[model samples]
Target: MNISLAQKARQNRIAALEYLRRTKQGAEAEGEVLNFFAHRAREKAKPVFFSVRARMDDERIAA
Candidate 1:
């Protein structure tokens, strides 16, 4: 589905908040300042991640 610019901006803000949480700086803010920080944080924020899986039994045996 197509998302609007504002919606995308909000999404970016949420991601930035999550990043802030990771770095122990998840204080709430608002308005232009929030958007500005969101944009900046989003730019520097790392991507979402999943943990690596353990090796399967067969693979472990081959090693």
Candidate 2:
């Protein structure tokens, strides 16, 4: 399933906040968390690159 950019950004921010809380960084880590999420969002905004390959059945072709 594909999620919208805004949804993904929101999720990233939530995760960053959770990490900050878990690490007990408190308010001091606020900037770091925001930067991390901003970078994550930018990374996600990049286009996805992939490749597809076709598999051939040798036995069927021989028959």
Candidate 3:
């Protein structure tokens, strides 16, 4: 299925929020993020992964 750019962005934002929530609660988001990265890495590799992380970090800092 093809996802629109807006849909993908929404999904990424949801995932990032969940990650931030987990980390703030002293929960382990490392494995979840790593698993997500590993799966995406097979398709688009490192750059996408880093970009996602960067966006997430940026959002975190802004909040």
Candidate 4:
């Protein structure tokens, strides 16, 4: 399925917010600043990760 530019941007923003949550700053989740931070990371060459932890957790889940 094809997504619009705004929708894709929103997805990026959410991915960023999740990254911040899993990283050393999980306590501070503000809706406003997530997109800016995410874009900054993107500019530095980081892909948008939707659920990295979830993917890794499959090991335990399978067991």
Candidate 5:
């Protein structure tokens, strides 16, 4: 692999870890960080299926 390509890959990894660290620090809402990663994963062509629901939502009972 070319040096330039390797450097770019390293930078990407470091940036990703930094973003995760910020999430751990609570710099942004937890949902925001999670959604950001989900969007990026899709852009990178990852196959991910997930279900999300708000914790405050009231449950419905079938009659």
Candidate 6:
């Protein structure tokens, strides 16, 4: 269940490539498709700040 950021990014890249293949756009817009997916992957890979705050609150409640 716990997937690393690098793994997620790789999966996204693979998905993008598969999408291109399925749509027959691999030869024409491969770069654009990859770039878009890479950008989204980076966004998804960002550290979630609110989770840390929520964890702290939960700890306080448990204590």
Q: Which stretches of candidate 1 lie over 4 Å from their true place?
A: 25-63
Index of the highest-lDDT prediction: 6
RMSD of each: 16.8, 17.3, 22.7, 20.3, 14.0, 18.2
After superposition, the stretches of candidate 2 with alpha carbons farther than 4 Å from their true spots are 25-63
TM-score of each model, paired residue for residue: 0.37, 0.38, 0.42, 0.37, 0.37, 0.38
Error of 2 at 49 (Å): 65
Return the lDDT, model 4, position 36.
72
Show pairs that collide, candidate 3. none
Candidate with more favorable, higher lDDT: 2 or 4: 4
Candidate with best TM-score? 3
Per-residue lDDT tens digits for candidate 3, residues 2-56, read: 9999999999999999987878566353433435676687768455346788989
User: Lowest-lDDT window of 10 residues in candidate 4?
Assistant: 24-33
Better of 3 and 5 by lDDT: 3
Q: How do the candidates rank by lDDT, highest first?
A: 6, 3, 4, 2, 1, 5
Summarize candidate 2's per-residue lDDT along 1-63 as a digit string, tens digits.
Answer: 999999999999999989977776654566444467767887786786544422235445666
Candidate 5, residue 20: CA error in Å? 0.2
What TM-score does structure 3 among the candidates reach? 0.42
Q: Give one clash count per candidate, in the order shown.
A: 0, 0, 0, 0, 0, 0
Among all windows of ten consecutive residues in candidate 1, which has the lowest summed lDDT?
25-34
- What stretches of model 5 exceed 4 Å from their correct place? 1-3, 27-63
RMSD of 2: 17.3
Q: What is the lDDT of residue 37 in candidate 5?
A: 77
